[model samples]
Target: MKALLSLALLLTWLGRCTGAAQVFMEPQLRARAGDSVLLQCLFLDPDSKGWTLHKVDWLHRAGAGTQEEMVFFYYSNHGVPAGRFKHRVQWRGNISRWDGSILLQDLRLNDSGTYECELRLLETSSVFMRCEGSAAQVWGASLLLPSSVTACVPSAPKPPGLCQQRGQPGPGAC
Candidate 1:
Protein backbone atom coordinates (compact mmCIF):
# COMPACT_ATOMS: atom_id res chain seq x y z
CA MET A 1 0.00 0.00 0.00
CA LYS A 2 2.80 2.38 0.88
CA ALA A 3 4.65 1.81 -2.41
CA LEU A 4 1.47 2.32 -4.43
CA LEU A 5 0.75 5.66 -2.75
CA SER A 6 4.33 6.89 -3.29
CA LEU A 7 4.17 5.97 -6.98
CA ALA A 8 0.92 7.87 -7.42
CA LEU A 9 2.39 11.00 -5.84
CA LEU A 10 5.45 10.84 -8.08
CA LEU A 11 3.27 10.60 -11.19
CA THR A 12 1.23 13.61 -10.13
CA TRP A 13 4.33 15.70 -9.52
CA LEU A 14 5.78 14.82 -12.92
CA GLY A 15 2.53 15.69 -14.66
CA ARG A 16 2.35 19.10 -13.08
CA CYS A 17 5.98 19.86 -13.91
CA THR A 18 5.43 19.00 -17.54
CA GLY A 19 2.24 21.00 -17.77
CA ALA A 20 3.92 24.08 -16.37
CA ALA A 21 6.46 24.02 -19.16
CA GLN A 22 3.97 24.30 -21.97
CA VAL A 23 5.34 26.30 -24.91
CA PHE A 24 3.60 28.74 -27.24
CA MET A 25 4.39 28.62 -30.94
CA GLU A 26 5.91 31.65 -32.65
CA PRO A 27 6.72 31.96 -36.31
CA GLN A 28 8.78 34.74 -37.86
CA LEU A 29 7.01 36.60 -40.67
CA ARG A 30 8.36 38.78 -43.44
CA ALA A 31 6.36 41.26 -45.48
CA ARG A 32 6.78 44.31 -47.66
CA ALA A 33 5.37 47.75 -47.09
CA GLY A 34 1.62 47.94 -47.80
CA ASP A 35 1.28 44.17 -47.37
CA SER A 36 -0.76 42.42 -44.70
CA VAL A 37 0.82 40.02 -42.25
CA LEU A 38 -0.61 37.51 -39.81
CA LEU A 39 1.04 36.89 -36.47
CA GLN A 40 0.03 33.48 -35.19
CA CYS A 41 -0.25 32.16 -31.64
CA LEU A 42 -1.39 28.61 -31.08
CA PHE A 43 -1.01 26.20 -28.16
CA LEU A 44 -2.00 22.65 -27.46
CA ASP A 45 -4.24 21.82 -24.51
CA PRO A 46 -2.24 18.98 -22.98
CA ASP A 47 -5.15 17.37 -21.17
CA SER A 48 -7.55 17.58 -24.08
CA LYS A 49 -9.71 19.92 -21.99
CA GLY A 50 -11.09 23.10 -23.56
CA TRP A 51 -10.87 26.66 -22.30
CA THR A 52 -12.90 29.81 -22.67
CA LEU A 53 -10.89 32.59 -24.23
CA HIS A 54 -11.67 35.66 -22.19
CA LYS A 55 -9.36 38.16 -23.78
CA VAL A 56 -6.76 38.57 -26.50
CA ASP A 57 -4.29 41.41 -26.60
CA TRP A 58 -1.52 42.22 -29.04
CA LEU A 59 1.43 44.39 -28.14
CA HIS A 60 4.20 45.96 -30.17
CA ARG A 61 7.70 47.10 -29.27
CA ALA A 62 10.05 49.03 -31.52
CA GLY A 63 13.22 48.98 -29.47
CA ALA A 64 14.74 49.20 -26.03
CA GLY A 65 13.37 51.70 -23.45
CA THR A 66 10.22 52.14 -25.45
CA GLN A 67 7.03 51.04 -23.76
CA GLU A 68 5.23 48.12 -25.26
CA GLU A 69 2.14 49.57 -26.89
CA MET A 70 -1.14 47.72 -27.17
CA VAL A 71 -1.85 47.32 -30.84
CA PHE A 72 -5.13 45.50 -30.56
CA PHE A 73 -7.52 44.04 -27.99
CA TYR A 74 -10.38 41.60 -28.41
CA TYR A 75 -12.98 40.63 -25.87
CA SER A 76 -16.68 39.91 -25.65
CA ASN A 77 -16.64 39.23 -29.39
CA HIS A 78 -15.47 42.72 -30.23
CA GLY A 79 -12.07 43.94 -31.40
CA VAL A 80 -10.60 47.35 -30.70
CA PRO A 81 -7.51 48.72 -32.40
CA ALA A 82 -5.21 51.26 -30.85
CA GLY A 83 -4.73 54.93 -31.87
CA ARG A 84 -2.94 55.14 -35.19
CA PHE A 85 -3.37 51.44 -35.83
CA LYS A 86 -7.14 51.71 -35.58
CA HIS A 87 -7.61 51.31 -39.31
CA ARG A 88 -4.74 48.85 -39.81
CA VAL A 89 -5.25 45.96 -37.42
CA GLN A 90 -7.96 43.31 -37.53
CA TRP A 91 -8.83 40.24 -35.50
CA ARG A 92 -8.35 37.26 -37.76
CA GLY A 93 -8.57 34.58 -35.11
CA ASN A 94 -11.33 32.16 -34.17
CA ILE A 95 -11.86 31.31 -30.52
CA SER A 96 -13.41 27.93 -31.27
CA ARG A 97 -10.39 26.95 -33.37
CA TRP A 98 -7.91 27.99 -30.68
CA ASP A 99 -6.34 30.49 -33.05
CA GLY A 100 -5.19 33.86 -31.74
CA SER A 101 -3.89 35.49 -34.87
CA ILE A 102 -4.14 39.11 -35.99
CA LEU A 103 -3.97 40.72 -39.40
CA LEU A 104 -1.87 43.87 -39.83
CA GLN A 105 -2.79 45.79 -42.91
CA ASP A 106 -1.02 48.54 -44.87
CA LEU A 107 2.28 47.84 -43.23
CA ARG A 108 4.56 50.83 -42.88
CA LEU A 109 8.30 51.15 -42.32
CA ASN A 110 7.82 51.82 -38.63
CA ASP A 111 5.83 48.61 -38.37
CA SER A 112 9.05 46.65 -38.54
CA GLY A 113 9.47 45.31 -35.04
CA THR A 114 8.37 42.67 -32.60
CA TYR A 115 4.71 41.82 -32.04
CA GLU A 116 3.44 39.82 -29.08
CA CYS A 117 0.15 38.01 -28.70
CA GLU A 118 -1.28 37.40 -25.26
CA LEU A 119 -4.21 35.07 -24.70
CA ARG A 120 -6.12 34.96 -21.42
CA LEU A 121 -8.19 31.89 -20.64
CA LEU A 122 -11.14 31.75 -18.28
CA GLU A 123 -11.88 28.80 -16.05
CA THR A 124 -15.25 27.10 -16.42
CA SER A 125 -16.75 23.99 -14.90
CA SER A 126 -18.12 22.82 -18.22
CA VAL A 127 -14.92 22.49 -20.21
CA PHE A 128 -11.89 22.98 -18.03
CA MET A 129 -12.64 20.42 -15.36
CA ARG A 130 -9.50 21.11 -13.34
CA CYS A 131 -7.79 24.33 -14.21
CA GLU A 132 -4.96 25.37 -11.99
CA GLY A 133 -5.33 29.10 -12.53
CA SER A 134 -6.19 31.75 -15.10
CA ALA A 135 -3.78 30.82 -17.85
CA ALA A 136 -2.21 33.66 -19.84
CA GLN A 137 -0.17 32.33 -22.73
CA VAL A 138 2.04 34.66 -24.74
CA TRP A 139 3.75 34.28 -28.10
CA GLY A 140 5.85 36.80 -29.96
CA ALA A 141 7.69 37.19 -33.26
CA SER A 142 9.75 39.74 -35.17
CA LEU A 143 8.67 41.25 -38.47
CA LEU A 144 11.25 42.45 -40.97
CA LEU A 145 10.76 44.68 -43.98
CA PRO A 146 13.41 45.93 -46.35
CA SER A 147 14.17 49.63 -46.17
CA SER A 148 13.93 49.89 -49.95
CA VAL A 149 10.29 48.84 -49.94
CA THR A 150 8.37 52.05 -49.44
CA ALA A 151 4.73 52.32 -48.47
CA CYS A 152 2.67 51.84 -51.64
CA VAL A 153 0.77 54.92 -52.70
CA PRO A 154 -1.54 55.70 -55.56
CA SER A 155 0.38 57.12 -58.50
CA ALA A 156 -0.84 59.58 -61.11
CA PRO A 157 -2.58 58.05 -64.10
CA LYS A 158 -0.49 57.33 -67.19
CA PRO A 159 -1.10 58.86 -70.64
CA PRO A 160 -3.68 57.12 -72.84
CA GLY A 161 -0.95 56.32 -75.41
CA LEU A 162 1.07 54.44 -72.79
CA CYS A 163 -1.87 52.41 -71.44
CA GLN A 164 -2.02 48.71 -72.30
CA GLN A 165 -4.95 46.27 -72.32
CA ARG A 166 -5.39 43.14 -70.20
CA GLY A 167 -3.00 40.36 -71.35
CA GLN A 168 -1.23 42.64 -73.81
CA PRO A 169 2.47 43.43 -73.27
CA GLY A 170 4.37 46.70 -73.62
CA PRO A 171 2.70 50.10 -74.28
CA GLY A 172 0.99 48.86 -77.46
CA ALA A 173 -2.58 48.46 -78.78
CA CYS A 174 -5.05 45.78 -77.65
Candidate 2:
Protein backbone atom coordinates (compact mmCIF):
# COMPACT_ATOMS: atom_id res chain seq x y z
CA MET A 1 0.00 0.00 0.00
CA LYS A 2 2.80 2.43 0.76
CA ALA A 3 4.39 1.78 -2.65
CA LEU A 4 1.09 2.43 -4.41
CA LEU A 5 0.65 5.71 -2.48
CA SER A 6 4.12 6.87 -3.48
CA LEU A 7 3.40 6.08 -7.14
CA ALA A 8 0.20 8.10 -7.10
CA LEU A 9 1.94 11.05 -5.46
CA LEU A 10 4.71 10.96 -8.05
CA LEU A 11 2.22 10.94 -10.87
CA THR A 12 0.42 13.96 -9.54
CA TRP A 13 3.65 15.91 -9.15
CA LEU A 14 4.76 15.04 -12.64
CA GLY A 15 1.48 16.15 -14.11
CA ARG A 16 1.77 19.52 -12.36
CA CYS A 17 5.27 20.12 -13.67
CA THR A 18 4.29 19.38 -17.28
CA GLY A 19 1.02 21.23 -17.46
CA ALA A 20 0.71 24.28 -19.74
CA ALA A 21 -1.73 27.13 -19.65
CA GLN A 22 -4.08 27.87 -22.55
CA VAL A 23 -4.64 31.24 -24.22
CA PHE A 24 -7.96 32.53 -25.53
CA MET A 25 -8.74 35.26 -28.08
CA GLU A 26 -11.51 36.31 -30.36
CA PRO A 27 -11.44 34.68 -33.76
CA GLN A 28 -12.48 37.63 -35.89
CA LEU A 29 -13.50 41.26 -35.70
CA ARG A 30 -15.13 43.70 -38.12
CA ALA A 31 -14.63 47.39 -37.49
CA ARG A 32 -14.55 50.72 -39.23
CA ALA A 33 -11.61 52.98 -39.83
CA GLY A 34 -10.69 55.63 -37.25
CA ASP A 35 -12.09 53.40 -34.53
CA SER A 36 -10.66 51.70 -31.47
CA VAL A 37 -10.43 47.92 -31.27
CA LEU A 38 -10.05 45.91 -28.11
CA LEU A 39 -8.32 42.65 -28.82
CA GLN A 40 -9.35 40.47 -25.94
CA CYS A 41 -6.80 37.91 -24.73
CA LEU A 42 -7.38 35.90 -21.60
CA PHE A 43 -5.62 32.82 -20.28
CA LEU A 44 -6.23 29.92 -17.97
CA ASP A 45 -3.90 29.37 -15.03
CA PRO A 46 -5.63 26.20 -13.84
CA ASP A 47 -5.76 27.17 -10.16
CA SER A 48 -2.15 28.31 -10.34
CA LYS A 49 -1.03 24.77 -9.83
CA GLY A 50 2.55 25.56 -10.80
CA TRP A 51 2.55 27.90 -13.76
CA THR A 52 3.67 31.53 -13.55
CA LEU A 53 3.36 34.20 -16.17
CA HIS A 54 6.73 34.97 -17.74
CA LYS A 55 6.11 37.13 -20.75
CA VAL A 56 3.39 38.35 -23.08
CA ASP A 57 3.94 39.37 -26.69
CA TRP A 58 1.45 41.12 -28.94
CA LEU A 59 2.07 40.53 -32.63
CA HIS A 60 0.43 42.02 -35.70
CA ARG A 61 0.52 40.92 -39.36
CA ALA A 62 -0.47 43.39 -41.98
CA GLY A 63 -3.07 41.99 -44.41
CA ALA A 64 -2.29 38.54 -45.78
CA GLY A 65 0.97 36.79 -46.58
CA THR A 66 3.03 39.05 -44.36
CA GLN A 67 5.32 38.62 -41.43
CA GLU A 68 4.03 39.25 -37.99
CA GLU A 69 5.48 42.16 -36.03
CA MET A 70 5.81 42.16 -32.28
CA VAL A 71 3.97 45.32 -31.46
CA PHE A 72 4.11 45.09 -27.70
CA PHE A 73 5.49 42.99 -24.87
CA TYR A 74 4.92 42.62 -21.15
CA TYR A 75 7.41 41.08 -18.78
CA SER A 76 6.01 41.71 -15.31
CA ASN A 77 6.71 45.36 -16.01
CA HIS A 78 5.58 47.33 -19.10
CA GLY A 79 6.04 47.57 -22.82
CA VAL A 80 6.48 50.65 -25.00
CA PRO A 81 5.01 50.32 -28.48
CA ALA A 82 7.47 51.25 -31.23
CA GLY A 83 7.52 51.85 -34.98
CA ARG A 84 4.08 52.30 -36.47
CA PHE A 85 2.49 51.40 -33.16
CA LYS A 86 4.32 54.03 -31.16
CA HIS A 87 1.21 56.06 -30.42
CA ARG A 88 -1.46 53.51 -31.17
CA VAL A 89 -1.30 50.30 -29.18
CA GLN A 90 -2.09 50.21 -25.46
CA TRP A 91 -1.64 47.29 -23.11
CA ARG A 92 -4.70 47.20 -20.90
CA GLY A 93 -4.55 43.80 -19.28
CA ASN A 94 -2.77 42.67 -16.12
CA ILE A 95 -0.54 39.63 -16.06
CA SER A 96 -1.47 38.86 -12.47
CA ARG A 97 -5.06 38.47 -13.56
CA TRP A 98 -4.10 36.22 -16.49
CA ASP A 99 -5.26 38.83 -18.98
CA GLY A 100 -3.07 39.91 -21.89
CA SER A 101 -5.58 41.98 -23.84
CA ILE A 102 -4.59 45.17 -25.66
CA LEU A 103 -6.51 48.16 -26.95
CA LEU A 104 -5.66 49.30 -30.48
CA GLN A 105 -6.58 52.94 -30.69
CA ASP A 106 -7.03 55.40 -33.58
CA LEU A 107 -7.20 52.47 -35.95
CA ARG A 108 -6.65 53.18 -39.64
CA LEU A 109 -7.39 51.10 -42.71
CA ASN A 110 -3.85 49.82 -42.73
CA ASP A 111 -4.43 48.41 -39.28
CA SER A 112 -6.69 45.73 -40.67
CA GLY A 113 -4.73 42.56 -40.17
CA THR A 114 -4.19 39.54 -37.99
CA TYR A 115 -3.17 40.01 -34.36
CA GLU A 116 -1.62 37.44 -32.08
CA CYS A 117 -1.27 37.22 -28.32
CA GLU A 118 1.56 35.05 -27.12
CA LEU A 119 2.16 34.00 -23.55
CA ARG A 120 5.11 32.30 -21.97
CA LEU A 121 4.79 30.53 -18.65
CA LEU A 122 7.42 29.06 -16.41
CA GLU A 123 6.51 25.61 -15.23
CA THR A 124 7.27 24.09 -11.87
CA SER A 125 10.13 22.14 -13.43
CA SER A 126 11.87 25.37 -14.55
CA VAL A 127 10.80 24.84 -18.15
CA PHE A 128 8.94 27.32 -20.32
CA MET A 129 5.58 26.62 -21.96
CA ARG A 130 4.46 28.88 -24.77
CA CYS A 131 0.85 29.59 -25.67
CA GLU A 132 -0.36 31.77 -28.51
CA GLY A 133 -3.69 32.76 -30.06
CA SER A 134 -4.60 35.08 -32.93
CA ALA A 135 -7.50 37.03 -34.40
CA ALA A 136 -8.19 38.55 -37.81
CA GLN A 137 -9.47 42.11 -38.15
CA VAL A 138 -11.33 43.60 -41.13
CA TRP A 139 -11.66 47.33 -41.61
CA GLY A 140 -14.49 49.15 -43.37
CA ALA A 141 -14.19 51.39 -46.39
CA SER A 142 -12.41 54.60 -45.41
CA LEU A 143 -9.16 56.44 -45.76
CA LEU A 144 -6.57 57.94 -43.44
CA LEU A 145 -5.92 61.35 -44.87
CA PRO A 146 -2.45 62.69 -44.30
CA SER A 147 -1.45 66.35 -43.87
CA SER A 148 -0.40 66.50 -47.51
CA VAL A 149 -3.77 65.29 -48.71
CA THR A 150 -6.12 68.05 -49.75
CA ALA A 151 -9.12 65.72 -50.07
CA CYS A 152 -12.30 67.55 -49.26
CA VAL A 153 -15.51 66.28 -47.71
CA PRO A 154 -18.56 65.95 -49.88
CA SER A 155 -20.08 69.09 -48.36
CA ALA A 156 -16.87 71.15 -48.66
CA PRO A 157 -15.69 73.02 -51.75
CA LYS A 158 -12.99 71.29 -53.83
CA PRO A 159 -9.51 72.72 -53.41
CA PRO A 160 -7.54 74.23 -56.32
CA GLY A 161 -5.60 71.58 -58.30
CA LEU A 162 -6.65 69.06 -55.70
CA CYS A 163 -9.79 67.61 -57.28
CA GLN A 164 -9.45 66.51 -60.90
CA GLN A 165 -12.10 65.49 -63.43
CA ARG A 166 -13.09 61.86 -63.43
CA GLY A 167 -11.30 61.13 -66.76
CA GLN A 168 -8.37 63.54 -66.18
CA PRO A 169 -5.03 62.28 -64.90
CA GLY A 170 -4.39 64.11 -61.65
CA PRO A 171 -5.09 63.48 -57.95
CA GLY A 172 -8.51 62.25 -56.80
CA ALA A 173 -11.95 63.00 -58.16
CA CYS A 174 -14.15 65.53 -56.32
| TM-score list, all predictions | 0.55, 0.57
What candidate 1 gets wrong by more than 4 Å, as runs, is 1-27, 46-50, 123-174
Q: How many residue pairs clash in each candidate?
A: 0, 0
- TM-score of model 1 vs. true structure: 0.55
Cα-based lDDT at residue 30, candidate 1: 41
lDDT of 1 at 134: 15
Q: Per-residue lDDT tens digits of candidate 2, residues 1-174? A: 000000000000212233333333222234445666666556544444555776777776664577877677777587667568878988787778767777777766565444555566654233232333233323233422221000000112333343332233554544
Error of 1 at 102 (Å): 0.9
Write down the worst ten-residue block by lDDT for model 1. 2-11
Residues 71-100, candidate 1: write the lDDT tens digits: 888877888999778899888877665566
How many clashing residue pairs are found in candidate 2?
0
